[model samples]
Target: MTVATFDTAVIGGGLVGCWTALFLARRGARVAILEKGSVGAQSSGTNFGNLRLQGRFPGQYPLSLRSQAIWEQLQDFVGSACEYERTGHLYCAFDEGEAEKLEGYAKVSESYGLSIERLGREDLKHRYPWLADKVTAATFSARDATANPRLVTPAVARAARDAGASVFENIRVSEVRKSGSGFELRADPDLRIHCANVVNAAGAWAVEIAEQFGETAPLFAAGPPQFVTEPFPYFMSPSVQTIDGSVIVRQTRRGNLILAGYPRTAADPASQRVPVPPQKTLAAMKRLAELAPVLRSCSVIRVWSGTEGYLPDMVPVIGASETTPGLWHAFGFCGHGFQIGPGVGLCLSEMILDGGTETPLEPFGIGRFRSGVAVSEKFRREFDERKTA
Candidate 1:
């Protein structure tokens, strides 16, 4: 077997792993990315592409804002726009209870120095005349944006390769064990990878790797159902969603409205299959129409979903391993990994190279799961009780 050496080995080629490799390679590290399949072909590529900042977990504001900064400069960093746009994000409220939730979310965002605009029913009608009368209140954040999920990971991987990082696709890592002061990764087709540090950003399949080091998390596989309508007139700009976690929709410049909703469907990582239930499609369609009456007639041209790791607490596991040195984990992001992917990568690179990052990652530490995990309300509301894996 041929053995390749690197300063850091990133296991997974999704946005988080690819961006980690890119930043590490840029810092003059010998980096290699081992992916089971093509980069971004899974969850990273199939996401709804909402780079939202509003309504994030309070502890995640710093990281989310940092990630948005990178998204704003993606073209210069990765040499592609990836269809990124700061078209803003509008979170609507259907009832007074939902409106209060929006207000609390806006306050949380404001504390992080993010500008949030609260809009009443008349304000929503004036700005988004297409919205239905039931949308009683809303909040808008210009900082929230969108991008092409399908294009980002590949572009970042190319940049990583350009910066002297080796990217090995279609390579499934079968075993990873600590070797002396470094680690050794054994993969299919008879290849060995040795590295001083290892980052397991393996998305849905990351828990298996973490368990190898005596670390465990209540990670499950699930994905939001996504649908896209046939091209129509381009009018809707901002990404819009309901505060009650019903549906989210955004229109492409090409006039197709992309829609996604909660009560995410369960996924199977072993089979590499993520099936979007027919009932979810119908329910999301109804919610979208209720949110915006004008889009009721829009025909859905396609529907899809992908496997994503979700923790019971609805938080991602990041930072160094609790039991193993030089090993880091960044996975189980639920379905919100796309927007914060870049920032997480950058932070990982800093931790690997510069010793630590300024970002507050203590909340996402793997040690939190040591004493059993608590299920979050958001998790309960966003996912079906039976569908979770």
Candidate 2:
């Protein structure tokens, strides 16, 4: 019979939402995170765990760099490393065209003050002898890192809770509407949450809340099919990916090889089911073997996918809401949410408390959808546009 009140109500418990709650609570604001399921049970936990700095959208460099700093000092920030490592990221190319693309990416990254090492064919072979002979060139960024996706969200949520934020799991928020000067969230199990501000970081299901506030984006649900092989020798250090977006493979300390690929599999957000097609798995396996001949005989033990929202422009919507006051949106990250999750959270907290952030988030404003979304070059090459709807 009693209603809960808070300074901010964060809808979704993934990395972004949890981190937002953590920072807000740490700043002495009352915060609550409403998650439909357990924390980190969605795309935040199922992603490839890549903290790649190269080949990112040029505009995202600021936030990415800020986030990488948080990840580097994760233990001091969240009290958990989450199996993080800065073992570096190697982007390889199989032909001249892809090789040229790698160079362009490296230049972009270098312009942003990130150190990038361009490697010729011989340099790659000399450094990584296990690489296939057909590889022509590569770009290595020692700053690009990775972490255990499975461990991060839960840890961050726990930190948020430790900082005095209330985390409510299995509470599906059905509606959020302006109530008086603030907003009220209606959820399952007869729960009502009143807060001065609301944050829509709901991952794949975020659009529903946005639409209610007279905002809409061309968001579609999809997931990159992922596979993990049985334990092998822990030789591979840095995470590796092909410039063509064929496959990305990394060897964990436990010796399991994790692989993910593009042309992502379509997912049903209504059912919360992301099924990995068997053919996609086979294709990823073949590409993985071609990347490293030594892993040709590795046995895949599992395959999976997670629901993630992708916008036509391949950038997220992060900023205050246009049609409604006291509301903010941070969703539709495509597949890059994991690495920048913390920085986005920090920016959101700043915007909510200090009235703005210095992160230059103008490019990702939700208002861009009204002017006609300009498809990014990466969106065209990374996904099958026909399936975006």
Candidate 3:
């Protein structure tokens, strides 16, 4: 079969891949997104729809803040009504220690012009009457918001198509290679195609694919299973997290609660399909009971799991591929990619079409790990702590 040629070939149809394709095509690059499954079928679809700015590492705060800004203007960018709102996100601290952590995070995040207020007992009760009695204080970051992952991913893919990009679903990118000035990508169990550039946005699978072309990074994954309660009322949650790390509940605009914490299965290298075990559901519900007693017995009609990619340092490698000349990466986001996905995509696209990103992709370059490359002292100190954390 004769293969198609394009300016760029994106190797994953998850959120990152779709965004890369959409923006590249918008910039006049003929693009094709090859998805092993349906768009967002992987962790992209499974992720809890929380577009948050709280609990973010200080370095990532700025980039994430920009992405969150774009999220506010997503409707204007996509020219479609995206289900998103910045109703606010809160981090619940059941004790003094938890509250203390919030204080440190607040001071660190202040440079980004982000506001994080510590909530007292009365403040907690006044804001969310459903808050559990155990909740002593909460940190509120009203700048954060959420969007329906299911709705957003497909909408992005559709917008990409409308803007002149092709999306091929159920086609796995079997192999990738550097061919002269471009990239040669083989899909399906093996269908060869070529493009001027390739974007490795395969989420969890990104590590292995980059390895295939002799470009590897320390990317690990763990699947976290969660359950959601049926619609109750339009209750705003601001994102919720516990000192015990037991549960996090964010009420959707539709009144349903997106719950997490106490995921059933651990990260399994064998299977991405995670089963929400009864134990996990019970744990989530119990925590919900402790946090929002009113939702303790809130019947849950749906349970699912999502696998998140993690780098050894817990940050994303958002710019380039070392071994391949015309390749780049926008993966290993752990759980924070959604908030940073768009801005990363825009910056990464510029780097690919040109040579560098104005947003400082230098710290994120894959070349840092080359055998002869020395680790940056600052990067070393930072990563060492993340490893310990």
Candidate 4:
């Protein structure tokens, strides 16, 4: 059968994949996205929609800054309502030790040009009295924001399609191998595609595609439990987090409180499915009540979970393939890729079409795990065991 060809074929139609295709097509490169399921039906759609710049790893701060700027201008290009809001992020510390840590992080983050304002108890009470009295110290970053997670990826996919990228949904790639100076992909019985370059943006399943190309890392599926409360009078302003890393709390414009915490559920690798255990939600609610007494009276309306790729160090693989030429990877953002999704796609597009990116991608290289040629079995086994357990 004659194979349809393009300049690039992006596997996995998550936010990264769709944005990559959109940027590539805008640059006049023929691009196609092959998705196994519906666009944004997985992690990207289910995340808490936090566009935060606070509490980011040092290496990720630069990329997140660029992403935040893009998110502000993104609606003009995507042509859809993202429900974007610059709600800011307030991280509260319940005690002296947590306050010290928050202060340290603020000092370091400020070195990177991030504006972090440390707030003492009196400052917090004066600015945000809605918070519980236990919050003795806090840090605020006003530029951090939120958006509608359900609307982002699909809007990007539609914009990519409108920009001349072929998007084939529900086409699971059965096999992918190097072809003559390019790569070939077989989706099913009769569908085949050949492209000069391939991108593995398959979210949690990216490990399998990376393995097929002789590259691997300690990536495992991790699920974060999320819940929303019934709509009430919106009292909370800025999105809140604990310096102790206990929980994240935010209130939507319509007055629903959203929460996520450390109580994790397992995600199945084979099916890429994460089950939301009711017990974890209960535990999260209990912790929330402890943090903010007002939440004790709130009624939960829904609970859910999203499967994200978690590397051992919690960073993602976001560079060219170490083994295969013309192949690239842009997955494994841990559970936080939603915020930097657009910036990552632009970086990958620049790397592919322009030979390099202005954004420093050195820290995200696949070779960090080992040599630039193959997977390290030792790292793989450790992460696999931890994931399964």
Measured by TM-score, the strongest candidate is 1
Error of 3 at 224 (Å): 2.4
Q: Give the count of colliding residue pairs in each prediction.
A: 0, 0, 6, 0
Ranking by TM-score: 1, 2, 4, 3
Off by over 4 Å in 4: 371-389
lDDT of 1 at 131: 93
Higher-ranked by lDDT: 2 or 4: 2
Per-prediction CA RMSD (Å): 1.1, 1.4, 4.1, 3.3
**Model 3 TM-score, 2 decimals:** 0.90
Query: Which pairs of residues collide in model 2?
Result: none
* Cand. 2 Cα-lDDT: 0.92
For residues 1-389, what per-residue lDDT tens digits would candidate 3 score against the true structure? 54889988888888888888888989989999998878987677777777878777677776787678778888976776567878687888877887888778778767789887878999978877878888898888888888878778788899899999998998977778778888788777557788888888888888878887777776666655667888987765577877444677788767888887743254554566656667778777877887888886688889887766766555778777766677888887866777788788777788878787667556666665564344433334434343211
Put down candidate 4 lDDT per residue, 90-141, tens digits, no spaces: 9888889888888888887898898998888899879887777988999999
Q: For residues 1-389, could you state the per-residue lDDT of candidate 1 as single tens digits? A: 88999999999999999999999999899999999999998899999999999999999999999999999999999999999999999999989999999999999999999999999988888899999999999999998899999999999999999999999999999899999999999998899999999999999999889999999888888888899999989999899989867798999999999999888888888998888878888888999989988878888889998889998889899899989989999999988899999999999999999889999998999899878677898787655467433
Clashes of 3: 6
Expressed as tens digits, the lDDT of each residue in 232-277 for candidate 2 is: 9999999999987788999999999999987788889989989987
Candidate 2 accuracy as TM-score: 0.98
- Greater TM-score among 3 and 4 belongs to 4
